[model samples]
Target: MTSNIGSPAETTQPVGISPYLSKRIFTLQFTSTPRGARLARRLVAVRLDEWGVPYGTEAHETTVLVAAELAANAVRHGHVPGRDFHLSLRVTAELARIEVSDTRAERVPPRPGRLPEPELAEGGRGLLLVERLAERWGWCPRLGAPGKTVWAECALT
Candidate 1:
């Protein structure tokens, strides 16, 4: 039930989740470019549709916005030429977890409530939006990789 949503044709098949859990997982790798960021967001919407979360619902909309902001940050701040960013989404009955990993471990976003003042010329409010919309959000170093994954969890209810 994937929606067109301008999803790029480059997406791969969704990975299967662990057998012990009642969860669905969707994972994809994208070029570290603005176009890739947009594709990530659009595919998120499509994936939500496949997961029974209709478009325009709060859950679907929140997850899409989080995907977009995190992907945008990956392209704008964590991009490594010739390297790609990764997006993984895990949806369970209770919540949806969104993880966006980029190859710049040193460029982690500032902790929530610690962001610098908002400026008209400088754009840094993405995390703030994530903070407000996500049930909880944070980041960690990408295991076995020289990078970090910023993650956000949103409640389905």
Candidate 2:
């Protein structure tokens, strides 16, 4: 099967690709639409369940919140006509990382800022929630393309 760029080369790369690298990375791409965002959140819950994170448990709760916010931003702020967003959950020995990438290269996600009043705002609270939940969170411009990926990580218990 043909593969996209930056995907590991089928033939070979080199030695010393982390001996303890993770094997349970789950990734999927969905259309850049509101429905897609909703699906992303549902999928995260399902996957976390598969990995034994019980519903309403701390890991499950934290991961779901992070996934939901990132996917919503991908749909709301980073969507481009005819493009899709990618959602990835990578769990290593020490952390769980959730990433959402979408095709709106010109727009960059702002750094998390102060929270607004709960009754006075209809928006601008997503990043605040992310900052409070994640151990660390940030974004990176997709190389060789016109999109950005927002990612968050939390410790593994």
Candidate 3:
């Protein structure tokens, strides 16, 4: 029921917020640099732990791998020099939704196709991995912004 998205910790916010106004959307944003991408992945692992999904568990492993690939794609393909990528891990007891948004508005995502063999090429298959692991995966134009967000959901049981 708390977040530190692009600001100070929620508990530090005035200390008398209406319960209805307190948000639970925890977002962690980082630069679109490779290091930031890497941090996104690591933070997911740590955040998952904080959320009671321990590292090395089946679900945590799956989610972190998904985060790594998607974050990597954001850095490699979605970067604009002055813009940063955004990562959000929203949980609601039943599911964990992971989103990575980047600031290259001109680029649209490709629909799924036959996956290239990782052995046969130097690239491709990132989304294929997502599709195979995540319960569902898709993308959307960034609402109120010039970028797009690629999102995937992993069920929590």
The lowest-lDDT stretch of 10 consecutive residues in candidate 1 is 1-10
Better of 1 and 3 by TM-score: 1
Candidate 3 clashing pairs?
Answer: none
lDDT of 1 by residue, 1-157 (tens): 1232224322323357432346677788888999999999998899888777899898889889988999999999999998899988887777889998989988888776676666642677898888889999988899889999999999987
lDDT tens string, model 2, 98-133?
A: 988888988886665544555765776787788889
24 Cα displacement, candidate 1 (Å)? 0.4
Better of 1 and 2 by lDDT: 1
Off by over 4 Å in 3: 1-24, 112-122
Candidate 2 positional error at 109, Å: 1.6
Clashing pairs for model 2 are none
TM-scores of all predicted structures = 0.83, 0.78, 0.79
Instruction: Compare candidates 2 and 3 on TM-score and give the better one.
Output: 3
Q: What digit string (tens of lDDT, one per residue) describes model 3 on residues 25-127?
A: 4587788888998888988888777767788788889989998988999988898987788888766555778899988878856654454656874677788
The candidate maximizing lDDT is 1
> Runs in model 2 with CA error above 4 Å?
1-21, 112-122
Total backbone clashes of candidate 3, pairs 3 or more residues apart or in separate chains: 0
lDDT of 3 at 72: 92
Whole-structure CA lDDT of model 2: 0.77
TM-score, predicted candidate 2 vs. hidden true structure: 0.78
User: How many residue pairs clash in all the candidates, one count each?
Assistant: 0, 0, 0
